[model samples]
Target: MKLETTHASADVASEVVFEAKGLKKEYDDGRVHALRGVNFRITQGEFVVILGPSGCGKTTLLQMLGALAEPSAGILHYRGKSLADLADPASYRAREIGIIFQAFHLLPTFTAVENVQMPMFETDRPAAERTERAVELLKLVALGHRLDHFPSKLSGGEKQRVAIARSLANGPTVLLADEPTGNLDSENSKKILELIIRLRREQNMTLVLVTHDLNIARMATRTIEMKDGLIVADQQVPQTAA
Candidate 1:
């Protein structure tokens, strides 16, 4: 199925996953305008990739979308409600968003399974159930065999897989990945992208990926190109036949 501009429209159904209108950001005492009235919408189960050159504010926009950073101006709605309306953004993030970073950001001291189970501490699930879920998620990322391996022991790809499993621990509806394959070799990068696409297909989750790689952007159903902190091109690529 193809995505449309109306996808970001406010009249969209309540099930719409994420929407941003007239978004703007500034820094350095208004010396830098990171975003200039940016706007976009993302729906549930859709994979949207944002592509940009350096200093285009891709990371800033992603941070805002993930609720890690607030927009200097504009409105962002999640599940049909404004983010500003949320009584607690931290709690919302814990429950609804999964953020993956390029660094993998795994605990050096914690084993793979422990890293995956970390989020469960904030949750009320029993320890046994948390362990089981972490194991299952690791297996989903094909890292069950390295469940006990520390970050230093696993290869870069394996570490990223572990991070992915950790991101999935909470079963978030939206997954925001920032340059997830940035540090990997070509083969490993392809593997990581395939894993993300497979997981999106299986879970029917909403995915917003920020990447510099054109090839990586092509994998997404829709590509939104940003420049100077504004969306210069938003295009839907033709899907390949089955």
Candidate 2:
């Protein structure tokens, strides 16, 4: 199945959310190269999937996009401003980017609603407002009835839904998901994918998802194939009826 996209072509110059030029990430005294002079631009409202085998630097690239790690060399920009020049990179990450991981990293002791409210603690929002927003997000993810349930009491799919709700707590513009469905069964994977697509459609959020599965790659508005720390292929996904 193909994903529905707003743009007729990837070349559409609406707005650039992210741009990387000669992006490189090295580790262990420059002995390990996670990204090698990678360069690409992700436009606002685009769903771009990064595909490759293990150790191909897809995750590293995602980390850079999420601002979880800094590049060793080259330039990384957000909204035409250099990431390194940001006054507070952490604030940018917390406010602008939402990240989902394969493990559904929910706190075992916290209830679903509490977990969803965790990100808001970083801001100065009132406690009551935080609770209200958390509940709204949980409802959006179809977990309103499970709001009081702990992570241990929820099913895998429910846990993932909680994670998804938590990722939106700060109202991020970009969502970065790494192997979001890798731990779920096929049916659950489909449910999560559908939820993501729906959220993107509703919010016009930019998405960068990393996965080894071709089926998941096919659901993106654009597919970017990475290999040996470099981008090998970048193409637009064909449009499909909503």
Candidate 3:
């Protein structure tokens, strides 16, 4: 199973980061299917949008990619290695994959900076280094002034910004975002999208974002549309020039 390799810099960024074959996820003793025999390859630095309506299995597929959930039947490989082979999925998640949910799952007790540092503890980085890095990330997302603010104190947009910073704490190679703008207002949603795009460019990150917004899907270089637990369409779209 040899994959095409490329030269250094931008060329090497074309290598596959994730590959799936016959991927399926089921529930209730196979009575409910979330993902149905999906197959795809996501390359490094690719911006992929999983577009579909509610209950279309986009989130389920994303969970599998992040190793938060296992596939019921089929192989899910990350960088050519099966996710099932990973001895510690937690480590894989903390150090390799970053996930952002729409809920802005920030701990109510922690400040913005503290929430960002939370992921680094799992990677066992030095305490001081974690705090320093967290501060840098928050500042990058324009939340430096709000470092001491807790989730309850921050606005919807600000909280989501903190979540984005927290997701990048470990410098993950890939970022999976599930309906990140669902809870945001139009103005905030545009801001969040811009921030994400900027970070993606600066980091040269591989991003898989799940959204039902057709306009949002147009921003992706490629889009995979899921329906009734299956990928009904997958095709190229105009890439965002930003």
Candidate 4:
């Protein structure tokens, strides 16, 4: 089954999904600045790739976009509302945003289907419905046959596929993936990238991915290059005719 598109007001649908103004992040008692006054906006249904070298703040910016961490300074808006002002940030994350990390992050004991069903536990859906949806998602990721396999029994690529399916469990409008291909081999990386691109096209989801691979960055609709905690360049990828 195909995933459903996110519902939104016309005004909200037309607006940018994420807007960051002078965004900054500091640590080590303000001794280290991870993100320095970065400003960017991600429009709805766009696939944006954040590209930078190590320690250049690409992951930090991704964290901010995913609501995994709060910015030390500057303003961040999600659909025209300040992220800090949200009444329930956890609920916002659970319902509106999905995050996938470099690590697979699957529970070792749970089967692939169980792992995918974990996200639905936060909602009020019945258990049977959740299992059905999880099964369907695993099939979408080409893991239908591995439903009963634990993480240890699966290959690295298969684990990542499970993670991807889990990320979509909530039908989020925005998907934030940070170095999703980092741990995969070249072949596996290509497969994962293609899967992500297909999902974005099929679901009309807004994708924000962080990667150091230029080839991976080239596949995005927009590429944002960062260096020394600042945005160095932002360019649109030229479209190839179908």
lDDT of each: 0.84, 0.88, 0.87, 0.88
Give candidates' CA RMSD values in order. Answer: 5.0, 4.5, 4.5, 1.7
**Would you give me the overall lDDT of model 4?**
0.88
Residues 1-242, candidate 2: write the lDDT tens digits: 22222233243346898999999999999999989999999998889999999999999999999888899999999888988788888888778888999999999989999999998898988999999888888998888899899999998889999999898888787899999999999999999999987897677789899999999888888999999899999999986722
Off by over 4 Å in 1: 1-14
| Cα-based lDDT at residue 130, candidate 3 | 87
Superposition TM-score, candidate 2 onto the true structure: 0.93
- Cα lDDT of model 3 overall? 0.87
After aligning candidate 4 to the native by TM-score, how far in Å is the CA of 207 from where it should be?
A: 0.6
TM-score of each: 0.92, 0.93, 0.94, 0.96
Model 3 scores a TM of: 0.94
Model 4, span 1-242: residue lDDT tens:
66854555343455688999999999998999999999888988888999999999999888888777899999999988999788888888878888888998999999999999998888988999999999999999999999999999999999999999999998988889989999999999999989988987777788899999999877888999999999999999976510
How many residue pairs collide in each prediction? 0, 0, 0, 0
Looking at model 1, which ten-residue stretch has the lowest summed lDDT?
A: 1-10
Return the candidate ranking by TM-score, descending. 4, 3, 2, 1
**Which 10-residue span in candidate 4 carries the lowest summed lDDT?**
4-13
Q: Where does model 3 exceed 4 Å of error?
A: 1-12, 240-242
